[model samples]
Each structure stands twice: as C-alpha cells, then as structure tokens.
Target: MHPDQSPLRARSAPRHVPPLLLDIDQMLDEFSRQAVRAEFRFDPDTPAVVTVEFLAERGPGVIWRIGRQLLHRGLTEMSGFSDVRMWPTLSGERPSSWLLLETQEMEALFELPTAELAEWLDATYRIIPDETELDGLDWDGFLLGLTGGPGVPGE
Candidate 1:
C-alpha cells in the first residue's frame, strides 16, 4: 500500500460546517417522519426512478440503513436506469448538470420550481427533490444525501 493512501490515514470530516448545506438541524427538529426515494435512468438526458420509502419514526435509526441496503439490492436486481455513478455527486459544493441528470428519482419527487429552474441549474440546491419511487438506477451516493428534511434525524 502507498504510504499516502492507507485506510487509517484517511482525512476526517470537516469540523467546520459548509455554508451550502441546508439547516439540517432545523429539519431534524421540524418532523420525525421521513423517507428516501431512488431512481434509475437509462438515457443520459433522462433516466428511470426507483424509491424505497422508510419510517424513521416507527423504529430506531436502523430502518433507514436497512432501507438503504434494500435500495442498493433493488437497483442491482432491477433494470432500466444505468447504475454507473449515482450518489457521488452531492459531495460536490455544486453538482454538475450531468450529475443532476441522473436524479430522476428526486426529480419525480420534487419538480424544480419553474421559477428556480435556471437558478437551480446554475447554483446549489436551495431547493430539493420532493419524494417519489423510481425504477432502475445507477450506483451513485449523490441521491442519498437528499434524504434530509422531514424524514432524516438531526441535532
């Protein structure tokens, strides 16, 4: 293994919070019920959507994790959207248009406010996807972070 690339030497999460992230703390307090949906897409321009709804309020935090595993299996087992690079986009301060294209699941859930379409295209997510089930999917983690708001846990 390279001296610079060891698992034990991995960088840590930033102590300073980023400015772009929505007030996740507020969302956690506003509501307990929550869910996440996924979508798969075949077309580079558009793709199929897949979703796995979850109930964080009904049980401990594990339900969300289980649902995530379910989503992974569901995408691998199904066909339709390409499962190439799915959720890695959200890590970016500003995701690429190419990244946004794969988010059929999120788009299905929440339409970009018509007013915000141009801005949404230009900046970061001041707004996010609603909630809807999609089919097939690429294996990207970008969509996973969208699981904030009413469903996700918080400070």
Candidate 2:
C-alpha cells in the first residue's frame, strides 16, 4: 500500500497546508464570471441603496446603480488591487457594520451587517478547501494605513 494512499494514515495525518491569501485579481475574475451581486451603501444613516454588479465582459468592470442613476462608468480594472482592505464586525451584529474597500485613488464603503459580508464573499469568490480558510487572515489591517478602522473610515 502506498503511504500517500493509505486510508488509516490519511485519516490520522495532517498535511501542511498553505495559508489562503486574498488575490484581488483572481477574486475579481471570479466575481465577474459568477455575476455576483451585492449592495453598496454610500451613506450609512440614510441607508442609500447602491447596486454593485461585477461584469466579466461587455461594459465596464462594474456597474454602480442607485434607482435609475449610474454613478461610475468604464472601470476597466480595480486600480491598486494590492491596497484594498476589508473590516467586518462580529457575527449577528445589529444594523450591520461596514466593510471598508479602499484603494489608492478612492474607497467604497459598504454597510454589510453580520453574515452579509461573509455571504457576499462566499458568493463572489471561489474559496479553496473550505470557507474556514478565510478566517486565518487579518481583515482589520488588510491594507494597513490605507484604512482607519473596522466600522467606518474615521470611526
């Protein structure tokens, strides 16, 4: 019996698994391919309804819409992919917190409460092995100085 194929050994053995790092480019690709959808709240107080659609082909990389208005057009690529950061609050939290999406040029702040961010991530990205792999990363300091805190940009 091959050691690698041995059932007993496989059951008891633990393989050295590499940490799952967030690859923004790949994530965007998956996001486009899957046609993922999520709500972007520009204003937390008023609960502004903003729609985010990831596009694989056709027009700009993303479509931002509020009611019948189009805010941005022709976003070829997410500039400064390495600099985006996300900060999610504890599960089952009220009114939801925020997921800080920051870039060198601008930031997209969303009020994603509790499992909303997690659900969005699961829907948009192809997680390897399992979703739990994502828990290893530090979302609070995802991009360091680019962000202010977990809930919002300033607070």
Every model's Cα RMSD, please? 18.0, 16.7
Question: Over the stretch 1-155, how does candidate 2's per-residue lDDT look in tens digits?
Answer: 67568777656523322221221222333234222334343322212223444344455555443421111110111222233323433545353443335556765554333344334333322322232434556656766535655555456
For each candidate, the alpha-carbon lDDT, in order, equals 0.25, 0.36
User: TM-score of each candidate?
Assistant: 0.15, 0.26
Q: Which regions in candidate 1 have their CA more than 4 angstroms from the true location?
A: 1-10, 14-66, 78-155
How close to the true structure is residue 107 of candidate 1, measured as C-alpha lDDT? 27
| Candidate 1: tens digits of C-alpha lDDT, residues 1-155 | 67778675565332221221111111122344123322221121121222212223445321111122222322223212442222221224442211112333532211111222223212211211222223234334335447543434452
Give the Å error, residue 148, model 2: 38
Q: Best-fitting candidate, measured by TM-score?
A: 2
